[model samples]
Target: MVERYAVPDHQWDMIADIVSPPQKMGRPRRDDRLMLNGIFWILCSGAQWRDLPERFGSWKTVYQRFRQWRDDGTFEQVLSRLHLRLRQDGLMDLDTWM
Candidate 1:
């Protein structure tokens, strides 16, 4: 069954566009939220990959994508963008966050 770790709309809305895979002449990207949720589930549940809920697709796929994002700096880009937005809105203080 689908679980709570599946990213809800509001949380996904914040990072959705940025986290989406870049479109190319290849397989259409899987839902970014699903993948993110899969990652979250693993981190939050602290389970073996084989234990990943099937609703999240194969754990290997999620693992590969997570590794890809980490290696390619996608996480940094997302953080940078979020920081910029928060700074513009006076919502994020590095002093407090750091």
Candidate 2:
């Protein structure tokens, strides 16, 4: 069954590199995939920060990471990369009507 707010494996694989970079320090990072799910959940649900469900990890960590990415332009970078990927795959039609 599909979990709410979870990223699909296929879709995640396409943009994982852009959104979830390998952190090169102290210890291995928490699962970026799960953190992303938590991020999407908050944004999509419009839930208050304290209300975040625990399965996705500490809401505090997720929120902090979200802010970091937003400030760093990673979101824009990911969108551009995904758009390019879609174009390459012919999934995006650039027809005049579109």
Candidate 3:
């Protein structure tokens, strides 16, 4: 079975560009989807960053990326885009989520 909290491919596709654009320079970035799943795993498990799984790579790296995304409002943009997409598809009803 798919991991309960893992981000699905479709959803990942939706935010992949925003999270890591193709024009980025330097050595290739760490796997964004893996980092994202690491973040989600921590959030869902309510665990400390140090407790992150080895499959997700270094906990420090994931934590740093999380901080960068948060401080840069990247999370906000991702959520906004997801909300819009779900709303347009009649999949999300904000009233119920409240």
Top lDDT prediction, candidate number: 3
lDDT of 3 by residue, 1-98 (tens): 55767888877889988987785578887888889899999999999999999989999999999999999999999999989998999999989966
TM-score of each: 0.79, 0.83, 0.87
Model 1 TM: 0.79
Any idea what lDDT model 2 has? 0.84
lDDT accuracy of residue 94 in candidate 2: 62
Model 1 regions more than 4 Å off: 1-3
How accurate locally, in lDDT, is each candidate? 0.83, 0.84, 0.90
lDDT of 1 by residue, 1-98 (tens): 44577776775678877788468788787777788889889999899888999988998989888998899988898888889889989998988987
Question: Which residue ranges in model 3 land beyond 4 Å of their true spot?
Answer: 93-98
- How would you encode candidate 2's per-residue C-alpha lDDT over 1-98 as one tens digit per residue? 66987889888987898788878788787788888888999999999877889988888998887898889998889888877888899888767324
Which pairs clash in model 2? none
Clashing residue pairs found in predicted model 1: none
Off by over 4 Å in 2: 93-98
Q: Residue 52 in model 3: shift from native, Å?
A: 0.4
